[model samples]
Target: MRLFPHPFAALVVLVTLGAAAQTPSSPVGSVSPTTGLVLRDDVVRALIHESSGDRIHDGVQRLALLARDNAGGYTEAAVWTKAAAEAAGLKDVRLEPMKQGPQWRATRGELWVAGPQRYRVTSHADLPMSLAIKSGSFEGADLELVDVGTGTQDAEYAGKDLKGKVVLTRGHPSATLRRAVTKLGAVGVVSSYSTPPWNLPHRLDGDFPDQVGWAIVPPGLVPEGQPAPFLFMVSDRQGRELRAQLLTGPVKVDVHVATEEYPGHYGILSGVIPGTRAGEEVVLTAHLDHYKPGADDNASGSATLLELVRTYTTLIRQGVLPPPVRTLRVLWLPEFEGTREWFALHGADPVRRVAHFNFDMLGASLSRAHSRFLVSYTPDWNGSFVNAVSESTVAFMNRFNGVAYPPRKDFRIGSVTGSRDPLDAHLDRYSRGSDHQLFNDHGIPGVAFSTWPDDTYHTSGDRPELVDPTQLHRAAFAGLSSITVAAWAEGPGALDLARLVAVHGARRVAEDEFRARRDLASAPATGVAGMHRLARAVVRAAYQRERDALLSCVQLGAPAKAVRTMTQSLERAEAQALERLDADSKARGVSLKEPAPSEAERRARAFVPRRVKGQELASFDELVTRAAPEDQPRVATVQAALREATTALRERGEGELRFYQLPDALASYADGKRSVADIRDAAYAEYGHVFPVEALMDLFGLLERGGIMTTAR
Candidate 1:
């Protein structure tokens, strides 16, 4: 449970390594595809060399062992992280507390079959993943094993009897339990669900037989008619073998689960590298809780953060990089619940909080997971220079790595003791589901860096060895470099950042406009008129996003006069782009006139959802808990609608997906000033959905009824 064995072993400090390499800049109007913001190249080189992958891996290996839910090892890890931060010489380090209502801790869980030979499928004593979180206590022997065939559906249980028995399911364990325990009288549940195998057949549960994906049963506060649910987890191989036995002959198993639920506080860890001035802050965050060996899901992000603190503190002390203009704070905390709770306490901090960078799953090997290191900009509705600056920053890795044509030098930044392979790094569009989403929802511009489609994601198969040391180094160098500039830029430095945002934002907006024009050409004859309105909306949306990005630079210290000059240019481009699109429409025989707001838009324009003071938003389950009994049914309906919007009703979905994220976006975008129509248009521009305003009313209605929000007409 100590965060590392010798946390300082991998702390490789930089020695004066010759004059720092100066990064050459572009022409007056041109920008480098890689690293648009010019800075002291010597300092950049020092950060790359000083950050040690071994150190990050060491911290991850240690943190992975302290795997418990909020009430147990997870809280202990927060204390440990605070100590580590203090040891690394960060200022104002503190372990902030948030309310964690009724936590679950599992002490005993085991699944074994007594057939011809006594065999244990798995045990919580050893793997810690054999038990699902929030499962109620239960003990039973010789329980008949019944195959429910993906127990997520009603018809799946029509002819089957599940009472006092253990049901085998490959469906989502929660979905399965919602059916079995609440309606079918099932006593215990076993799950082997994993993502379906894709190319290389990267089926985690199949490829790694002992890996257990995390699962949770219903909380103790279920409706009166429902029995408390308990769950036992097994890998795909075990589930398959058990089903085989059931098909041949009657199979029975023994199960014991000991769990306790108690009220506790979630820990939010914070520490900062003091800046030259007070009030302004550049924030960094990563979640610190997951299952054992939740390395890539979070430990990677958590561990690498220690490296950021180490590198930055050392560089400033050694005078390699100047102290930041704004205070730089790093936070390690429990994921969603903790973030929401923290925001409730400091949602309106008077200090001019600037931007946020969230790092998650940043240590996966590209070859193993077939993953690309992805960086997301702030959502277009809340655009900031983070997207443009970060895109240009990480491009350094992609362009400078491996061999190239024209016989250029390979300036790869790899670890001496880590994998030295070509990195599959890319810049991505805005994505949800990270700490950054919370910051953006709270009104700060934020970006998240991560790797996706990880092979061992959420499975016990994720271990320290699965993390590539070189990958950690890559993330630290790129992440630390961008944030340091954000926190440090002023005067000329701020101007450089503005220029970066202007050029990149222009290209990005142009790309969105091009797509709109392309879609316009293919609009159906009957829908051409509507398409014109849609195209105009797209142009207007693009203008807003890019304009926001340009404006964020002033916070970093860009001159107002210069920024105004740049805005005029963007306005001209916007007008010209719209004119060109209209000209193309005339050529295509659409001959459409500019349109006015439709009836739905008018309704949206008049209504807004206003937040109630100190009434913080929580997760779907917690929100249900807040509602009165009569309103609970409405909460349930809204929860389903929310799921369909963000997750397409399930983690995996059918057919083509539209802005299924409308459910997630509405609450975040309901910042009092935005009319329901403004929220809808932003959602349409960010995601390709032309939904009716009525589709979003259920959530606003629920929030207003719960006293968390008020709808103003």
Candidate 2:
């Protein structure tokens, strides 16, 4: 039994009700004369000035003030905590406070570039050496300081007697020279640079030992009387002559810098919507603070949560939704630590909750501007129910809005989505990177709503004027729909009671299986093998027993819950196997290893399907012709999957690898627009058979990846 209905029938309803489905309306107002919603002129006018609209710059200013006024740049964080509490009007908006140590500490002498003699001497204020001087008896060590050209990877450093004395370097690669200098018995080295360019690539290896003086010296590295170091000035002719000469020369060295430490708190603001039923809870989440204005980066998400609360409250008041059967808790955490503390305090409720809906950076206009798409981040195939909800939300948006969005590319999602793959798949891909991570990590189905900045993300220029409010509305609508649907789906009496019980029971069984296989090391190999054999037999028997039941229910239209339960059961079986292996290995004081694959499994894993080249499947004649068969439900699923995959693949411009779509490969193949054969051929052409089916399945495994394509099977 499938939860999805027939495609032809669904398609008609979709076409006719597309606007209505995508854009929900207030009872007071109707859609425009053409398409989509039309707020009453008064209402539209009011929204223009609404605080919830797009007050990003204001929020950013607020953040800046908070950072500046508070100790350790955390007072701004406290302000956010307060704002979240005040916004919800909940005295106990789950305010949890935890301190984060100094984000950066300077230990070495400060290096500076005035006109650039490339100085390395000590500071006027008792500053440390720019480079730790180590002199091992040079015995008559008549030493002179030397200047290596700019420290670019290709910069030449060959023109000086750089032994037994100090050396000054130009840029980044200076640090790489420390050991070599030590080997050469050079007393010291100084790497210097002027004020940086507008943009700086985040270097992963920025930190170094304090002994080496990885410092920031002052503007007086060049003496007031002396000319600047050779090749320091950047006149056009100078640059050309230097380029021609590849200038390298001796330079006096001076080092100076001051360091300090400050303490601050990373706070998370949380609120709760008490539930009516026992043992059920739902959490709405977002992060409340950041280092920059973070408009689309996050100010949008924070604001989205604010508006969502209003909408949810309104919907509740209007009786559009039932009183929540489960507890509904909203959390505005200070990213990771705040979430961790909440989990510690609240215990395991997150995992046990009905679901979680997260709002983070919901107003990014770039996706829409460039691609007319809304992006979502959910868990990978190895994800859980929480992940499914995230994926489902995106699908709902697409279906309701009748808009095309990127398919769930595991690799792409994995990157901007943020969390490490394999280990963090179940957690918010962007969680550890942002705030949704803790809930997702605890097994609460969670999703991150973010609009990545096109040009301005964390910069000072992330002003409110740059934000697109219409896009915010779209994100809000999408988020609201997901929350509403999840509430209905997970709420008591929302679906057949028996089916829910079956789903829960089946999930437990799967967990039990996982625990078993996960502990294989604790049992004898023969017994473990026997248990696996029996497990498969049990699964076969269970399928046989339930197959007819499921098919009959489908034929009789028993209910949607039945399909959800059956699918859940299969998912559980797989989960159980993995868990069993993990648990067994742990019990035996050993770790479970990735299983050696047979040829078929290896081939399946190795395959990388070719995505549609240029045109969208909706635009392709063959796809339309293939899609014409409206009777088969699988066609819709396959087509939707291909549509998303193709769109995402194309969006990834050259010079960048697929990081978001992790474990990169085609997953399961069904003929929507492209057949399994076509996918296999594509993979053969692209990556060969080293790609595995499991990898592909994992890529497309969870529902969160589906975004708007949730209607697909």
Candidate 3:
């Protein structure tokens, strides 16, 4: 039966339920005066009490059984996902066909060392990851093993004959296969690129000493007219043993890989919870494809999404919660490829998509996997209030589940079955890896929920036993609460969200101010102007972010009074931040005003900036490689400088080293309508600082020389 008779009826029911759920003591829809947050006591209580970790665990267990090895596995996952969603009473459950690349499946594979003391190594029948994905079929063949440490560079294979041999290397399988097997005529490859240093002890001393991880053979990387080579990943322990044997004398091995490639469609399982609004929707997504027993990597995420569906369905059916005003759409698909295909088909009409919440690797056991839950924000290019909302929800959950100050205090809100360990989740800057990247690329604001530093990630050791049900429960709650509040936010709830944005904005401004001060203090006199420019730019970005948040509330149909109040609050905060920045500038004797560009600089600005399209643009590695022959000394200097800069940036909490300042920011401003000068000026307006004309010229010249940009006209 339908949950509501009509759209209007659904709206009325939601309003009525909101009114009924309120109480005098802790009103459900009341705004907290101190925190400026909506107190959704009823919804929080329901989520805490009704959400089931056991159900999440059961789903992960069932999914763990599926090998998910081929197109068949992908189809099987879709079928099961559809069935589960239907059983949960979700509406419009169906499988969407995604036509992308050919399907790859490993039917059988085995490896053994035959010479100088023979022994069995591993088999695909035992562990799917033993054979890398896209490995070709090969019968039993005795090939000598050659040690070519990280066979990616030509120097590594200078004096070696790798013909008809199995190359052993510690580099990525794809890179090694391309260089060793395809170029050097090796029969196969064995890679031992294990987990990071933190996970070394686990593999060395743990029960799964022979555990391996999955690798891929990229078709694009192979030499033209040469078929992809067979590859396998083995444990570091096994690899070490083989290398030791090779040290004494030549070691021969028998390798067999049975695999097939065929055409197949990617599957996307989707279930909808219809709401009062017809067009507007919020999507919850999780990838379902992975190696066999891929529990912590992705089975955990899929299971959490399934549990969320069941909980929402049950609550609505039981009359404990009303239907959302905006439709809630849950989707399961393969990772990047599937999401890309989905966008290719449905990207034209994305105006109704409120937000996309992506879940990946959300159930790793902290003690075993050394995992930390992370909620990554949307990129600055696609800034919205969604980041603030999601971050706030995670913080709220931490209050109850986070490490207590006094220790062992019962601070949890509602009774729920799971771990009492602190929620220890952190908010991270935007990164590109999973399905969320595709959404963000299509102009949709999205967030990704994941656990990092997982020792068992993407490895054979990522079994269902490594999943923590409590982690799953908490992740599901954060996602559900954020999306639910976003869908139903109006009146007091909308006001509270605006306030949340204001608070978050203030904190962000403070962080920028701190960074500016540090940069100014450390910069040399010659570089002081650039530093000041960057600091001003940071302030401008911060205020713009606040404005974006307030505008998002307006888009959400928030009450005018609430939006006005929030806008004024944001303006006041921005003004105060600017005043402080000016005061600091005066104290530092730095000029805030920019000088007018000379005629030469103005002429330089006339050059239109257009990003290069299509393939064959040289990669950074290729650039370094090509430069080595022309200018060895220059290359060494550049490399050393880069290393030093990287070290400094890492110390400053900037995880990745960026040699150029504001590459993405500059690129964002390089629309066809904007000239180089126009783009620079606009960037300055947005950032409150402009790079020196010479610096801008050098950046644009480099882009043009590298074929990454060109004159539009």
Candidate 4:
């Protein structure tokens, strides 16, 4: 699990150099038709050679030293990042302040076992993660500890007093705090939550015993009238020890936590590498905020951004690389909250942002962290050719790095320094967890580069020593190459991108067809109509995606004639695919139309739902409770039924519900311009079937009650 490869491994790699160069097709230079940028052999060679893992490692180590739990930490990180950007010869480097409420910082924290022999447990002075984030100041002596397993549900608290006690649970700190402290009147909480073992890589052997990085909720973000409580995160080892002691007899702990909260601003550092075009840019982004010593969770990502900027700026300055035709802007943010604020403020600009390459948890060593480098795309629903470009770039790098061949036959064209291990990287489907989600939600094309199933994620065990420099280098190369190609892509490059999109779309359509066919085969007779409807809808969606990809080429300044020809060809291909699917449905005797709705259902469809802008769901819930007292019981009943149905489906081993589940797609269709019937048709077009007319009406009625929507008569 050490960060560095063994000396014997290094020796073996060195001895196999001759055999690594035998791949004759692995040429040094080639033109990328998609970007219209020639892959200069000397420049490519220099990029790989000059990208320094040491720089990335050192940057991570430096950032890891700052206490990043509050506004002060945010400020310090921004300062350091700005300095690094300036050093890299980047322009327009500055910190943009986001309007946020007071920040929380722990001044002091300590815990001690008082019963069965007094002994020290943990202290914030020694290790910051011992104190949960956002935990308020508290002092307690000889407080009894009560076990409330996974203390989120009401059943977990049954038969337990919990009052004035420190409740223990194997749940996320935030969830445990809400139940054990806010509801059950517990003075504090101790949680031993770890990432699920099943989700981890096989090589890790499920050995994640690290303290959680719990944070107290910020002032404005916290729910109205709820008191934030003190909480502590314990490693699994400590929790097990405490549990064993409790088995012997009653146990007590002495705890003291001194924390401060004050008004502060979220800091975002940004710089630009101006290109020939004034308005177009490709964004390179990573979040800079995390707990102290949060190396892999975010320091790795932030450091990788720094290293990439350094590499690009250095190359551009030395005249080894041409400046991109479009600007490359680098941004360091404060994760989701900060990203949301930034978008709200600055995202309405007329300037064209081509794409975003986001880095998060990008420096974990494959050997140490049991991680694979993942190039995660935006969801298929948020269709774009960005994923294809990223995949192609990573494929090239992997081949060059010998990831696809034996060590003896591996090409080390980009092996500047570190282990000769092939880039253990692959492309992953869209997943929502990081800042990239913000961009995707706003219709921006974004991709996330991350190391998945990080064992030390959000834990004290996430420290600088756990980061892998070689991994950082590979990530930088992947991100840099991708953005470089995107920023400079012109007519020929745009055509190349269009081709990739066409190929990718065809494959996606085939995959969807297969899934739909399998679903249809297993469906009940009553569900056959819905299955066919879904098939038609999926085909239409695929065609729309292909259309959007072709349109992007036009946006990228491709020749109109070429783009037009490509679009026409793609449209024809899509038509044929759709026709084939329709024929298959007919042969299977599947009906593709639904029965007409009743008069009552027609009335419901006439109702138009206009969403209440800027209202949070919780606020909307309260609004509904106040505005439609008569309908409250019905809404509650529906909510309970939905939850039960979801639980049953999950229990039956169905995967997580798709986006069209319940009211999600329905809500999106709730523009005032769309009637209830229109919305139903739209839903049918996208999902292949609509919710029952009554179900849709009930949802809209609830939305109306909550002021989330105003229905037209």
Q: Could you tell me every candidate's TM-score relative to the true structure?
A: 0.87, 0.47, 0.82, 0.81
Please give, for residues 283-320, the per-residue lDDT of candidate 4 as tens digits: 88899988888888798889888888888878776656
Candidate maximizing TM-score: 1
Please give the distance, in angstroms, between residue 319's alpha carbon in candidate 4 and its true position after superposition: 2.4
Better of 2 and 4 by lDDT: 4
Instruction: For candidate 3, report its TM-score.
Output: 0.82
Q: Give lDDT for model 3.
A: 0.70
State how far residue 354 of model 2 sits from its true place (Å).
3.3
Model 4 alpha-carbon drift over 4 Å, by segment: 1-46, 152-162, 172-179, 196-207, 210-228, 401-421, 521-526, 590-593, 597-713
What ordering of candidates by TM-score runs from best to worst?
1, 3, 4, 2
Question: lDDT for model 2, on a 0 to 1 scale?
Answer: 0.40
- Number of backbone-clashing residue pairs for each candidate, in the order shown: 1, 70, 1, 6
Query: What are the per-residue Cα lDDT tens digits for candidate 2 across 100-135?
Result: 553422333333322343432333123222222211
Q: Which of candidates 1 and 2 is the stronger one according to lDDT?
A: 1
Candidate 1 lDDT, 23-74, residue by residue in tens: 2221112243333445555555677788888889888888888774546888
Cα deviation of 187, candidate 4, in Å = 1.8
The parts of candidate 3 lying over 4 Å away from their true place are 1-28, 33-39, 115-117, 152-159, 196-209, 221-227, 404-418, 590-648, 656-713
Q: What pairs collide in candidate 3?
A: 537-687
Among residues 3 or more apart in sequence or in different chains, the pairs in candidate 1 whose N, CA or C atoms overlap within 3 Å are 645-660
